[model samples]
Target: MVAEGAVFTTDRTVPIGAIDRWCSALLDELAGVERELWLVVAVTLVVDVWLTHVGLQHGLQEGNPVMRAAIETFGFAVLGLTKVAALGLAGVTRRLLSDRRGVVVPLGIALPWAGAVVVNATLLLRL
Candidate 1:
């Protein structure tokens, strides 16, 4: 339960502006470079999955052993789960590091996916 003075509480006496201010502040925190990095991560995830699918159809395969097992068991839907896990990892990173360093979390995730995209495209070309 929140204290009586809490910005967000069940107390109906609290003005609407308080809630708006609280939400605005949270959105403010979410704005900036870190937000852009998260966008990069999101784009790469979708591209990676699409490229992975195309590669599989063209005789290439998942290079990562763990992901291979996952795909074998759960199929392509595993990519969606992994994407959620990646975002969870980014959230954890955001908590642990400052904004500057936290950008690394998404960068780390994006780079490998981008690299895989390159490799997948190359292989597909060869086929």
Candidate 2:
């Protein structure tokens, strides 16, 4: 729907390059935020798993089956929260792709591997 002359125009004056640069800067900021979210997820998962393991060990030592079950349940709940966060990210990514503002392509391109790393780190921590 863009006219030929308007294709590279912004503000009826600024060139498309300006828009590109602005978008790039915005994406860079978003990337940093995404990295932090992934880190939070990773750390939370690790802590959950470690706590679970410690709880299990204590339960076994004390011969308390109920306490072992309770700890495992709590640990799984934490892991489940991470999954929820991942799903939320996926939804946001999808919305970004469909956005008319045209920011999605860069974000989508930058997000997958980072998200995967978070998930893998979390799962590995549990083991």
Candidate 3:
């Protein structure tokens, strides 16, 4: 029997196996997201390479000092290495995002790459 205005509550504990399954599902989802991110990184690298070629043709130089030095000293090999580094960083970003869910993480992952795309497009158009 319950009195008027009295509240009843029930507490349930999740089973360990259920919790493990849930965690595994979540990790699988994150892995899918990471794969998508890698795809984006790959596409971005292709576009970056094309942009670099266009920029070179137009006499535009690498803006980052370290990359500029690499380009000057080691040529296209360094450019390839830099693209590889960018892909690695994207992988790192995906891992970080998996660990920490936040709006800023995705934005931080995306904005700079998007900015580069825009800048490259603008330069290619202008040249």
Candidate 4:
């Protein structure tokens, strides 16, 4: 089973009208691509802050003594931020490609590298 939020690819069928409606809704939101980018950035920052504190607390409280030495409280926060940044970039790149619209084009270009770095840093380098 795919875990919640786990990234995967699959094919789906939907009516053209449905897709059009969805795109229209997205475009109508908050006026323009710039605002959308700002909103994404703000949300990413907020999530980074909250996830960092929570990950640190959880690691410190629940991990074994040996695990404690391997994990840095703040590092988790950084990792979270990195992931968010990657996703934000991807979103921007996708939007831009769709129509010089948002930041999705740049994001699409950067997200893969960002994700790889984050994964290696956290899982390979840190632990």
- Best candidate (score: lDDT): 1
lDDT of 1 by residue, 1-93 (tens): 668877874656877699888866655564455668678778888878888888877767789899989998999889768878877977897
The collision pairs in model 4 are 89-107, 90-107, 91-104, 92-103, 92-104, 92-105, 93-103, 93-104, 93-105, 94-104
How close is every model to the real structure, measured as TM-score?
Answer: 0.66, 0.28, 0.58, 0.34
What TM-score does candidate 1 reach? 0.66
Ordered from best to worst TM-score, the candidate numbers read: 1, 3, 4, 2
lDDT: the better of candidates 1 and 2: 1
Which candidate tops TM-score? 1
Positional deviation of residue 59's Cα in model 1 after best superposition, in angstroms:
2.4
Question: How many clashing pairs per prediction, in order?
Answer: 0, 0, 0, 10
Candidates 2 and 3: which is better by TM-score?
3
Which pairs clash in the backbone of model 3?
none
Tens-place lDDT digits, model 3, residues 1-127: 8899988768777787998788677666655575465466567667777788688778988777888887888886688777777667755765676453422344454557667877888887886
Instruction: Evaluate residue 17 in candidate 2 and report its C-alpha lDDT on the 0 to 100 scale.
Output: 95
Local distance difference test, candidate 3? 0.69
* Backbone collision tally, model 2: 0
Give the runs in model 1 whose Cα sits over 4 Å from its true position. 1-32
lDDT agreement of model 1 with the native: 0.77
Each prediction's whole-model lDDT (CA): 0.77, 0.52, 0.69, 0.50
